[model samples]
Target: MASDLRTQDIQNPVDVAEYLFRRLHEVGVRSVHGLPGDYNLVALDYIPKAGLNWVGNCNELNAGYAADGYARVKGISAIVTTFGVGELSAVNAIAGAYSEYVPIVHIVGYPSTASQKNGMLLHHTLGNGDFNVFSKMSKEISCAVSLLNDQHEAATLIDNAIRECWLHSRPVYISLPSDMVQKKVDGDRLKTPLDLSFPKNDPEKEDYVVDVILKYLHAAQNPVVLVDACAIRHRALDETHEFIVKSGIPTFVAPMGKGAVNETLPNYGGVYAGDGSNKGVRERVEASDLVISIGAIKSDFNTAGFTYRISQLNTIDLHSYGTKVRYSEYPGVRMNGVLKKVTAKLGQLNVEKGPKPNNDIPDEEVKSPEPTITQAWFWPRLGQWLEKNDVVITETGTANFGIWETRFPADVTAISQVLWGSIGYATGSCQGAALAAKELGIKRTILFTGDGSFQLTAQEVSTMLRNKLNPIIFIICNKGYTIERYIHGWEDSYNDVQEWKYKELPYAFGAEKDSVLTYRVSTKKEVEELFLDREFASGDTQKLRFVELVMAWDDAPVALKSTAAAAAKTNAEN
Candidate 1:
């Protein structure tokens, strides 16, 4: 009474690729950004079949940036590339993701085991024929690395990498060898139901630290909460809003941590770092008696290059690793379990409303804004233009400014690969974002990018045309790398870029002439008219429009001077 059954088998490479692809889909990764190469042919073949969209980019760098952007909106994203050259090209974007703490999974294809054993200098082989070059590079970017050495390990490793990314809020690398992909494994052996839970602050020492913080807050006449990137990465947005509301403390978000709370909140103090920050933000921060920095890094950028005064006694630094009070006798406490414990204790105590600081500038002064092309001007204007339900994807350069400047409305959503300041990220990301938006029934998608960065992935314009997606792309044509110019003195040859007829790109990419539209403006008047026009829709073959604004390359955003000043002040203080 033995039963015989029909057995069906898939190629090893296809199986491995499909397994990983399905796993990604289950975890909410709908689109993958990448540059296809010979080494990754198997994965490429399986991508479309797995029901995941493959966003092809002009280069690996752009692909990485696009993935980073998608992650900013969706909380996590992935990038795929070939062995050596492809991985190396993506390093800049990956490093940016690391810096900003975006969750991106990088999948790199490698040479077969035979090639490694035979010591062939195959295509993309780094003289050693070892894939560790990518492993080491990824490690340098502070990302966790895993290799699919065995077929059985592929699913587990892929799951591990994704989990690690969610936990660490950083990029993770997975190297897939060519031959191992298609091998079969017990379907039950695959990881079951991946968890997205983040590591929390430790509870054991929470009572003591919470007591100390509460004591300081009660005694202080003025207190403030400084929100930073870690808060956003930890998905503590709601918790932060509740904490601020309960405490009745004014709040300031780090430049990289903007949109953590409603900007329209009564206690909102504005951005304290980067372009949109007010001139008096540092003074307000320094004047505070107690500063509670929740999930903030003590990095130079977030701390105004360490320029502003933070009494080691008054600072409470909270991070994933632990909690510490600077310049205090209190010992650092592990944070994994501390936040809940601290919140529980503090939740029991009655928080009293204190006198609010007069941080607002007078209407007259605020009206006569400073003459700078900073986030102050950019964000508010952009905010006004955005609809309640629209999705905003920011490229690295101007996008960083938008993070600091723009206020998130109730229905408006914002996304950027802040961790990876990869140029040319916004264009391809726009494609992914638009696709996702369409799938979700979101009508409008907008992209804000700089001219220099846009050129890096301009090829994706054709992809948009092919998909028939209508996304309004705003190219800030300053004609150079403005961020670099601010960090290091501008070198004309290095920072300057040739001006492009940006509005013409759509037509060059086979977009229907009537369906595509172009707008070039230098003044505010023209910007208002073109930005508000309702005719710019996907169906209007006459509407594949590109708007180019002529801005000065030397025009530093608002935060640049403040940052420089803060650095100088820190140097003097030190």
Candidate 2:
């Protein structure tokens, strides 16, 4: 990869900011998300110099959210903000990343080292003269924190922070002092890139765990492989897929694990969220003699409000950190190596004769005289309409629960926050996801979000249009927070939202008249016709597509109704 472009020589020195950003670029961060501020302005200069684009966000929170989406797609992402006000605004997003295991590098530009040490009155500060307050608040959520206050250890500190962020697959904090931005650091260190490889699991233990799993796997009359969020977040899909394909066992996923398994495979079943499962899927999964769960998170939403009837005595849980067979715990027995060994050592299994799992989408109703769109009809229909390799993002409301009913195409990437149910996240995340897809030359990036939640970060569409990122945005105009109403206050006005001309947004966002396509579909017929349109449904990634899909405000998906009821019972409100 050497070139005559006269890149920073290994023998020479590079500025601390340059070292930090170059390391980010090395790990596939093509764009840095954040807002420009006085303290961070100079450090932002190094972004482009280090072969990265500066994605200026309208707000700090959206920047962090955008970074989360970018990391979900690109493996890792970074964001730069000012010392106090900016970093604090982004703390919620960073916390969300930490909760959901999204790797993001949160870089904060501080006042000069001298000013911080001498307690100079800084505008962004809390005026208490305690400069470390914000970083201290962030330390709880971040796996590692690096304060680049000194030039001597800047390079090493930066490398450590980035490594921890990637290794844990969580957010990390790196505070860069304004004065230290240009401080010289050894550029030779960059020649030998950060050791980003994961430590190998002890082979003996991994194989032993694999044997235990296989013992049950072989004896079971009926077995099912359950893939979940950690399977993807922990980067174990390669091994999981190998085991699923090799074992030929019926495979299913938790809601958070949607898109983890390829639905095109005969062995691949639909989602299994306890009572919220796809028709026969629940009965089939629960009836299995042994349930092989991989990186599964049994969260409230993930397990249909923890209604998983599968017996712990019949389940073997394989996780990133450890393995659990029945009730016996095998701590430190990671799944990646164990699954790989299982797949390699596996022989013919006695797969009990049973009805094969099917993700059958119901035929559209042609006799609906009123042609009203319902959640049940929309979700399953979406399964039929989705194409391969598309990146689909769902917001934390109805769109999130509704998407569980849909089956994804092969290699399709599904992004949503089930663990951290943040309302406004998808819009900002879509902006980042679309840009990431664009950078990878992917044809389409689609987003489904409630109009209420979209309003929280609606301005992010402007950011997408400004960057010329073409994402198909579906703003489910259900009038208000339907999910919230379903959970509590069904008739309360607080659950309502103000309406907007969502379809006209592209034009208002400065997109060229012909550069974007807008649609407002109220009836089932309109939706069917829109999906059937060759230009709209085809892989026409050239134009931005925004759709306003109107639905009944009181309506919710079957999963949402049950999940919300369970949630309400578990946590009583005032």
What do the candidate models score in CA lDDT, each in turn?
0.69, 0.89
Query: Which candidate leads in lDDT?
Result: 2
Count the clashes in each prediction. 28, 0
Runs with alpha carbons beyond 4 Å of true place in candidate 1: 1-14, 189-191, 199-202, 274-276, 300-305, 328-379, 393-399, 402-406, 411-425, 432-443, 482-494, 536-545, 552-554, 564-574
- My TM-score estimates for the predictions, one after another, are 0.83, 0.96
- The weakest ten consecutive residues by lDDT in model 1 span 1-10
Worst 10 residues of 2 by lDDT: 1-10
Best by TM-score: 2
Give one digit per residue, the lDDT tens place, for model 1 in 202-320. Answer: 45456777777767766777778888777777666666666776666778877566556566666777667533355556667777777888777655655445545667678887766
